[model samples]
Target: MDIHFIKENIPLYVEAAGLTVRIALIGILCAFLVGLFCSMIRYLKVPILKGMVQGYIELSRNTPLLIQLYFLYFGLPKIGILFSSEQCAIIGLAFQGGSYMAEAFRSGLESVSKVQKDTGLSLGMTEKQVLQYVVLPQAISTSVPVFCANVIFLIKETSVFSAVALADLMFVTKDLIGIYYKTDEALWMLVIAYLLLLLPISILSSVLERKVRYAGFGNTSTVSGK
Candidate 1:
């Protein structure tokens, strides 16, 4: 599979992979914050804010990341707004990912029963305390699988960063294939690069899930601190 060619291009792939990871990590972090805010709004049923969040979630979730990237990179400049390719990639990833994260978090938050919240309140736990101690813990535990999946999905979505001219892994692979006609070698490296990036996260998620279970996050008795 052109081992020499692959070896020679290792540095190029590494640089691209680094850029991809940096952008994905920043975007995912921003998305989680956005999702957390939206999920809280939905969970509490905030009036005007809740509706806005709903619309945003719908818009973000329905549109493709490539479309969002195009709008940010191309459409915005036409209207006097401008961003660099890196900025566009990050924004698009966050925009697309926030909705999915919101759903995951909202579902987790909702799974914490009203009865449990009431029980926490009855025990003299303040509302904030109840949320901090009771609701959030259980919700996070319940949502781990979904949250991890969203993280992986968002990272993979970085493949579209090339649409904005970012030198991400996909961009490098395509560039190599086009320039050298080394399709098989480039494709194999691309798959290996992605596996290197994603496999640890998948493994870590499984470990985290087990840790959550053992830590008694969802256990009723643990919730009550008994």
Candidate 2:
């Protein structure tokens, strides 16, 4: 192991790590927004819209992300919808993550009691208002831990972006290995970088899950009082 070379390359690794974090953050944010909207369609139970959202989720989930990336980067350009490699990477990650997130949110929403919706309706709330004010808050709370897990997975999945020559952590690591022929060190660094990112998320998810549980208990108590 070339400790001196590894020390010399610290700045390069930092730059690559930053790019990886940026891409993952942007992709995860887009996925969360899109996924939340898709979950709402399922919650509303609108016939046509629900079907459309289901189709999107199924298609995105069933496909390999590599193929998705290729389609976005190569196929789209042929049809005049051009995108940069970074954009394609982010879009691919977002779509992939969004599909799973939709399922996670759907499961969370389904877990909420139907009585809650009924009570909202009885209180003169519109369907949309009920969903917005009552159901979604609880559903989101229940879903946060699962969504956090998805975020961790999505962070790891950013490695695939290297296929398109994006300068993310894995891509730069591969370049370094090729240049210096230190494959073992490069691989270990990649593993450590992923662990550093993912471990904190796992701990955060556990904490958030406990907080949500306590909040739910508090809400129940308040409702009983009134």
Candidate 3:
């Protein structure tokens, strides 16, 4: 199965895999931050902000990621918003992942009991203080597994960056296949690269889920009351 070609191209594969991981890592981090802010906005029920966040989540979730990438990479430059291919790819991935993450965290926030909010208020805490000190922490713990799974999905989705010639793992794999005509080997390497990136994330998510469950964070009975 073109073992010789695979051996010869090891360095290329490694470099491509590194780039893929780097892009995914950056995108996931950005997504998490953006998503957290968006979720908070939704939770606060701000007069205008909730609608904006909902629109953003709906727009991003409904569109094809490829179209989003093309718009970022091709369309933005016309308006003088210049970005490199890699930057465009990262932005697109972050925005896409952020939409999903917002929903995940929103669900977590919803799962938080009204009693917890009342408890914070009974302690003379402001709404902001209650959200920051009580709701967010509980929501974060509850959402850990979903966040991890979403991040893993983001890693896989980064393959789409190849379409923009971002020189990520999938891009390099395609180039290798074209050069060596070893489609099977190229695909196998791609699969292995994905496994390397995602397996640990999956395992970590499972561990975190078990920990959260055992810690009683997942139990409705643990919620505080005023």
The lDDT for every candidate, in the order shown, is: 0.87, 0.82, 0.83
| Number of the top lDDT candidate | 1
TM-score against truth, every candidate: 0.93, 0.91, 0.92
Stretches of candidate 1 exceeding 4 Å from the true structure: 216-226
* Candidate 3: C-alpha RMSD after superposition: 3.5
**What is the C-alpha lDDT profile of model 3 across 136-190, one tens digit per residue?**
8888777776787787788888888888878888888888789878899989988
* lDDT per residue as tens, model 1, 1-226: 8999999999999999999989999999999999998998998789999999999999999999999999999999999999999989888888899999999887778668888899999999999999899999888877877888899889888888888888888889899989999999999999999999999998998788667666444443333200
Candidate 2 ranges with C-alpha deviation above 4 Å = 217-226
Candidate 1 to native Cα RMSD, angstroms: 3.8
List residue ranges in candidate 3 displaced over 4 A.
Answer: 218-226
Please say which candidate is ahead in TM-score: 1 or 2.
Answer: 1
Given candidate 1, what's the lDDT at residue 177?
A: 86
Clashing pairs in 1: none
Query: Order of all candidates by lDDT, from best down to worst?
Result: 1, 3, 2
Q: Which 10 residues in a row give candidate 2 its minimum summed lDDT?
A: 217-226
**Pairwise lDDT winner, candidates 1 and 3:** 1
Which ten residues in a row are the worst by lDDT in model 3?
217-226
